[model samples]
Target chain A: MSVSDTHRTIDAIWRIESAKLIAVLTRIVRDIGLAEDLAHDALVIALEQWSQNGIPNNPGAWLMTTAKRRAIDLIRRNKLRDQKYSEVARNTDLYTEDDMDHNLDGEIGDDLLRLIFMTCHPVLPQEGRVALTLRLLCGLTTDEIARSFLAAEATIAQRIVRAKRTLRDRDIPFEVPAGEELSDRLSAVLEVIYLMFNEGYSATSGNQWIRPLICQEALRLGRVLAEIVPYEPEVHGLVALMEIQSSRFRTRVNSRGEPVLLMDQNRAEWDQLLIRRGLKALDRSQKLGRPFGPYSLQAAISACHAKAPTAPETDWIRIAALYEALSRVLPSPIVDLNRAVAVSMAFGPDFGLQIVDMLGNESSLKGYHLLPSVRGDLLVKLGRFDEARKEFEHAASMTRNERERELLLKRAAECNSAH
Target chain B: MRFMFIVKATGYSEAGGNYNQKYTDAMIAYKKSLAGAGVLVSAEALHPSSTGIRIMYPSDSEKPEILVGPFLADQELIAEYTLIDVDSEADALNWALRMPVPTGCGEFKIEVRKLKKNLGFLRYSGTCALEADLKDQLSMLKNF
Candidate 1:
């Protein structure tokens, strides 16, 4: 292989092995920032040696061994420095090479889980959590993570550096939380993953509607988490929801790059494999015998759409029922709005209009464009063309997406022609 | 992103030569690792070219031509393929590089190609930003 090819191979190996290497090193050193530094040190060493001697047979193990050696050397140096400074500091916990060897083999899965929890800890800001998670758990470079989020590379680098510092300063334990704390911490982790997925699934601020690469990364991370925490129903639930949603990615927009509503999407074009995988994940969540959380409830709703042969054949009643259950578990105006849409499909536009009108006074949804959009659709169904046109125009004005605004204006025009 | 790793057919593979126990064990272990990472979408080995047929359109007329295989050029034919969904091309390459070498099968090649997914909006709307960002990121990776 050429020099560039060898470098690319090393980079690939680093991507695959870095997460595990960092996770293990953190456990040994008990410092996330230091662990990362040691892992990178090992990577630099591998880049030099692998090109000379060819790649190792087991690259992950090779990297781990190299990183562990560096960790031991650093600890020894720190111990010597501490001994010269103060006698009391000599008693601090430090691992020898033998201790490191004993601790390295097993519990790597647990170490990774702990790493996820640490990165997604509620102590850090949401953006920090996201940046840290992508950096530590997904093995993404600062540049790649920056590009994925459409942020500046230096900003991402600073965010990562600050997040690691916070993790160290706060002295967060390198273990998964337990008891009631476990569920809360797990939700934080799930929220970070879901946020990453949504950032890709729907570009809230960009001209592009979908960023498939970010979604793929989020889905891969969710899958990894699900394997590590198989008993956590919500983990499987989140995976199921992402899988089902991702199946529609191809059909979510048109050839001209206009948005396509769920009902208008081509059912035959939806990816069957992903839908099946999602259903299987949902089944796993159900088998865990826990009450459906927000994600599972949503996945159950998506499954209803996936199972339907066509839009008209969708089980709106079941979906409405699921939405009602979801509202009780995780009440929000957005859930209520979705419930209203399902109710309209299952019952009548008047019934849906009543719910939508009630949400008119919802302070949280005052600036939410989807409210007016849904209300407009119901008003049109009820033959209130004038009101529907006004609502669509309002929605069009409120929306930030150029394509969605165009769609809303088109709806308003349709209402005008109908009248 | 999703990638397909296509293992090219070799003379030994085309002749249906059996793999030794060591190679078979290594291949199984490699597949297990792929599944453990939750990246393996599907993997399958194809039957020899003799079992396959190809349909071709003759350019001069509307008529079609059917050809039976035992086709020429073993290097051009695929013996097997594994599809994996990963975070990036680098991650896919990482997995591909770890694949066990097939011993006593002469030399073989695994070609990696990304599966195309619909990103019409990104292509049409964010072409400049996306291409420029990707180029910048590639250069950054090269520096590392």
Candidate 2:
């Protein structure tokens, strides 16, 4: 292979392997910030030498070995500074390659769980937690994250810096919280994963409707978490949610990559493997015998779709009921908005409009483009073209996604023609 | 000497609104380039002053004055910190001069100064205990 090809191969390897590398490194280093820095140092070395040397047969092993060596170097340098840094570094060196290989077999799940918990630690603010997790665990760039949130790159960049510094400054322990703290931290972990999945499902700002790489990463992480904390009902719930949602990935976009709305998608295109995984996860969630949390309830709703042979065969009433349960457990304006759509499908547009109208005064939905988008769809169904047109136009104006904006504007034009 | 740049103080309104992805990508590239050159130590964008209060020590008194504001002014916010492993301020500025144009907005500034160890004052000052106590209080307040 040419030098550029080697560079490309290394880049691809990093994208695929960085999370596991960091997870394993953090296990050894016990400092997330340092683990990430060491990972990057490995990446830099790969970028420089891989071109001439060609890609290694075991690229992951190469990266891991390089990162560990870099970690040792960093520690040795720090050893010059203070007794404390030296002592920590000395303790770290006790684990050799044999120890690492052995530890890897035992600690893959535990280490990933630890990394997730560390990223979502309560000390960092919510945005910081999400941004940092995406950067480290999902291998997303600051630009990718900013685009995902429709946020400024500078803003995401700043959030990440502060997040790392905050973690370092506070000396937050790199481990999963146990006991009561376990569930609370687990919820944060699940939230971060779901947040990642959601951004991928409907990219907040980009031209594309979905970012499959992000969704895949989230699903992989969720699966890892489920393995690490097999008994945590919520972990299973989250995995179930992601699996079912991901089943529709192929059907969600058309040949041209334009979004095909849920109702318009081809049922045949859904991945049966993902659906089966999702159903199994849902069964696992229920087997735990806990009341269905928000994710599990959402999964149950998705299972309704997975069971259906076609859109017309979908059990709308069950979906509506599940949404109601979701609302009770995690009553947010977005859930209510979604419930309105289900209610409209199950009952009638008039009934759905009533619930949606109740959300009209919700401050949270004031700028949340989806509210107006759903309202427009319902209005169009009710033959309220002028109002629907206005709603679609409003939604189109508010959305940052270029493709979504185009679709919304097209819908608005359709309403105009109908009128 | 490792120099840190603090963002300047200015109105959040004057800082303008949140930028778009294109602007943000540019900033990331800028930071990456700086990292490549080994000049950029660290950079962070703070939450607008609206999210939290800002407190500052008055030169005349030990107690700091609180203000509800962000780092809005170019002079107030320390935009970039250029840290040179080699000797002094001159070396730090030499690295800072290579930084690309400000990523998204108004005039940006860079400050070149030595990181204060303050070991002597830390040893002699009676206030060190109080400072430690304050840090403990702040740390306690962090999560909630």
Candidate 3:
């Protein structure tokens, strides 16, 4: 392969292996920021050498070895800080590629989990938490993070930098917390993971409807969590949610990256592997012998879709009931908003509209784009074209996703033509 | 030192806040899992920015002006906050590191500044503009 091809190969490997690489490196180096920097340094080396050497057979292992060597060199260079050097060097040899590939299962999952907890730690702001996770776990570039936010490159750059500095200055631990602190921190961790999954599921502003890489990484991490914390029902719940939701990736967009609503998607396009995995995870969550938590419930709802052979066969009433249970477990305007959609699906537009009207004055839903979008759908069903047109326009104006905006506007035009 | 993991809300982050049955269940399950493991302190998703405003530094340095709705920064978007008390900065940061991005739409920035020591300042200085400013800007602000 030519040097360019080699570089491309390395890039692909990095995309696939960076999270695991960082996860393992963090365990050895005991620094989330440093682990990432080391991983990048390995990337820099691969970029320079892989072109000449050809892509290594075991690319992740190669990267791990190269990073470990660089880490040793870094420590030797700063021998003046010999004690610090020894602290890192002592564990350096312990991590052979196979050791990481096989044995250090506890550490690998824990490191990733710890990294998640650290990034989602209460010390850093939430934006910082999300950015750090995307960068570290998703292996997304700063530019990708910026694009994800519809934000400027420099702004994301600063956020990542500031977040790292904050973590360092505060001396945040690289291990998962225990006791009550564990649940608190774990919640933050789960929140970040689910958010990552949702973004990939329905990108807010990207040209693409699905960012497969993001979803894949989140799912991978969630699966790892499920394994390491087997008793934790929510881990299974999250994995289940990702699996079922991700099953729709194939049907989510057209070949040209245009949006495809659920009602319109070809059910055959859904990934069977993901559906099976999701269903299995949901079953595991239920077997934990506790009331189904939110994620398991959602997974159950998605299961409704997965089980259906066609759109018309979707069990809207069951889903509505599930949403009701969800609301009881966790109440929010957004949950209410979703329940309204189910109500519409199961009963009629009027039934859904009543629920939506009840939520009209909700403090949280005031600026939510979906609020108007749903209202427009309900209005269209009521034969209120003028009102629906206005609602669709409002939704279009409110949405940040260019694709979503287009769809809403197109709907608005339909509403206008009907009048 | 106690640290607040501020959950910053961007437009993208808020998009997934109100999800259908599946999404909400996923979030609640995750929250409950966190609760089971005993790590969650307190958390809440915030309302969309349309319900809020951005108060910027006024032309006159002594005053501030509030702009209506859409508080996302032109360059940086911050969504919400979470307050956590940990044994060390590393502990706080490790936890913050795991926090899911809001809706996974945007990034999260955790500002790990130590909480300021109250130090009887309120008692000593019964009334002051700085204190008033803190109250208005930071004091009464609850973590989401």
Off-target runs (Cα >4 Å) in candidate 3 are A44-59, A76-88, A91-104, A147-150, A204-213, A250-260, A340-419, B1-144
A-chain TM-score, model 1: 0.88
Local accuracy of candidate 2 as per-residue lDDT tens digits, A1-419: 88777777777899887988898788666678779988999999988878777777677777888887787777778776766656766776444444556666556667777788889988876667878888998788988777666655755676677677778789888787878988778888787778667656654233464454666778988997788788988889889988988888777667676656556667888899999999999999999999999788878987887898966677878988987898898887667766787787788889988998999887766888877877888888888999999999999999999987998999899998995
* Candidate 2 per-residue lDDT over residues B1-144, each given as its tens digit: 356654443343245565556756776886776554334546776655545567889899999898885444545544333333323478666655654444556555555556776121001111221222222222222211
lDDT of each: 0.79, 0.72, 0.70
Ten contiguous residues minimizing lDDT sum, candidate 2 chain A: A203-212
After superposition on all CA atoms, how large is the RMSD of candidate 1?
19.7
Return the lDDT, model 2, position A51: 78
What is the Cα-based lDDT of residue A341 in candidate 1? 70
Colliding pairs, model 1:
none
How accurately is candidate 2 docked according to DockQ?
A: 0.02
Worst 10 residues of 3 chain A by lDDT: A203-212
Off by over 4 Å in 1: A80-106, A204-211, A361-369, A386-417, B1-144
TM-score (chain B) of candidate 3? 0.52
Best by TM-score: 1
Q: Which whole-number lDDT from 0 to 100 does residue A313 have in model 1? A: 73
lDDT of 3 at A39: 92
